[model samples]
Target: MIADFDVSSDWHVAAPYGFLRGLRHEQPVFHSPHLGAYVLTRHEDVRAAYGDAKRFSSAGSLTISRSLTQATRDRLGEHGSFLSSFVANVDPPDHTRLRRSVSRAFTPRAVAAMEERFRRLNEDVLDRVEPDGRADFVPGLGHIPSTKLTARFIGVPESDEEFVKSHVKDWFMLFLSPQPADRQLELADSFLEYLAYVDRLVAARAAAPQDDFTSLMTSLIGSELTHREVVELISTILLGGNDTVPNQLGNSVYRLLRENIWPVPADLTQNAVEECMRIDGASLGSFRYAITDIDLHGVTIPAGALCLLSTDSAAHDETVFDDPETFRIDRPNADAHMTLGYGIHFCVGAALARLQLRTALDVLGERLPGLRLAPGQPIAYRKSIVGRGLPALLVEWD
Candidate 1:
């Protein structure tokens, strides 16, 4: 009997590469009833699909919960009103305008200017951890710096950094579905609180100018944006500035420790960072809608069909990288990994993230060369249909 792909199976999330290996070999384009989105597993197909944005429009509900998958459809239903104001939902001319407006802030030069500050902050985080010799790297060291950077970029005062970071972390979990309904409802509360927080920041910035993204937004387009739009955009960047980086750093560190690759060679640090992402990146996949009928490797994806571009699987595609399962920081093609994606929708914060990761590896190697996962502590991953990350990563050093 032939076995069809099951995206929601435990094997897929916990040990996805084994299952993804089968996917790339046999079913490059699969539509699972459980997932509802057409899964593109190979690197070439995924990149091509991403490039053909006209057919694979990103507009619509970007949730990973296959609401059409029976039980989810009945329980959670679908909420389309969520991102009407989100910048990610916009396409073409508007995407062009909004991205251009903020592009100046995330440029390589801009991010470079701010590097020393964050480097010092991350180093300080590790410095404080050195005394303990053992620390929960996730929130202890990871999320803290991201929270500070979020405040720095958003132009908010860091007085309530801890308070806001707590809420932002909660808000970040909203993207992950397939969890209990109770957790979903709780996240709703956190989301509202965060929105209110951003709203207050928006109002405060409009009243008194500050040198930050908030101040920049209030003056854009003759200040024609509604209060609602400003709130939505700020919330969007809050996810960018707070959510992804923390988990990414945690995940990267987790990979290094698990593979016994700590004190990684200096020359291979950059390649190691990319290799970690190639193995298991923070993002599970991104969502796109088939605006028109599309054909893939003998499968027909009907118009309006939801598409899950499995970027994780793409990195594991054997044709793209030799011995894909092996973690080799020396792999020269590590930069080709598509976790940040390609084409017009490539990650805007790539430079900042790379800078942070590069700096983080440097600090870890320098400060605690003997870093290893804490003994006897069970590491846990926060499951999300759209991403993968550790809830806590405890580590110790000699």
Candidate 2:
């Protein structure tokens, strides 16, 4: 069955565990013809690969699918070269400075400061949902808070928040999804427009200082980072922060409810969120290019080969967690999951995201302890090699 594994197939995105388990068991590191890249599924291999960023470079690695066609490439190229400048894709010295500059604005102190705001935002959103006894879980539960908090996180003004919410950069991930060519062909032009809009925001922030993240970044620009770097960093935060966390809200609640484990004990629920993320976490990991022909676990990855590190599968590796496949609310060591990523490239907004998830779920459970999946409603997950997300989730509370 491992021989037949196909990354491009619909089944792989929706349900890959059966074959991913086979890869970790039979071949920890093997190149699959279907994926057109070398894959590492075992926990040890995935963690090591992430830690060895010196050997495994992150350039030109925005997605794990590696499916950009000549047409998509040309369309994307017209925008600008800033995509490669993303903090996640840059190597060592450059990565160090970029991350430092971004962190300057997103300090742990700053993240902690947002907790009260998030708690209120959580209350505000849920306050509306409570009266209905039913609500759209994905947006009502996750997207709204993610979008609002990120707007606050990035320092965008109230007038522009709607635009920020509208262009969540889901299109960027859609490029990797299994959509029709025409629909796929449609993303780049709009992306270029969104890029222009962000460019304007960067300019405005630079001109008139504000208390938000963008103005803070302006202070660091030139002295610590390039103007282009600011654009990339903000773009990454705006889009990435918006896309992943919202979907995770739906996925986490969905999993917990399906297992009949909602209203998780307050003591261990945060760990339950950690466990939720480990199992098929945001996007199925990402790509790293081998700097030179190298060997790992007896498998030789050629020079210039793209290695898709299966962080999702790694979570399930029997060696890491006692039972990765199960939803365990009381797991002692659940934070070990690599859902938000690892090493220097770990998500800058992780603390803020965690506060959002914990606050949202805790609020929902306390307010609507009997939330249930709506009858006759089918669950939906957006099809993508990266970005494991749901568009909507319907739930009712008696």
- Model 2, 48-151: lDDT tens digits are 88898888889777754535566766777844344678888788889998888888776778888887888788888888878898888877767777777888
**TM-scores, each model vs. reference:** 0.91, 0.93
Candidate maximizing lDDT: 2
What's the lDDT of the predicted structure labeled candidate 1? 0.75
Give the poorly placed runs of model 2, Cα more than 4 Å off: 3-10, 63-82, 174-181
- 98-134 in candidate 1: lDDT tens per residue? 6676676676777897778887888878778789888
Supply the TM-score for candidate 2.
Answer: 0.93
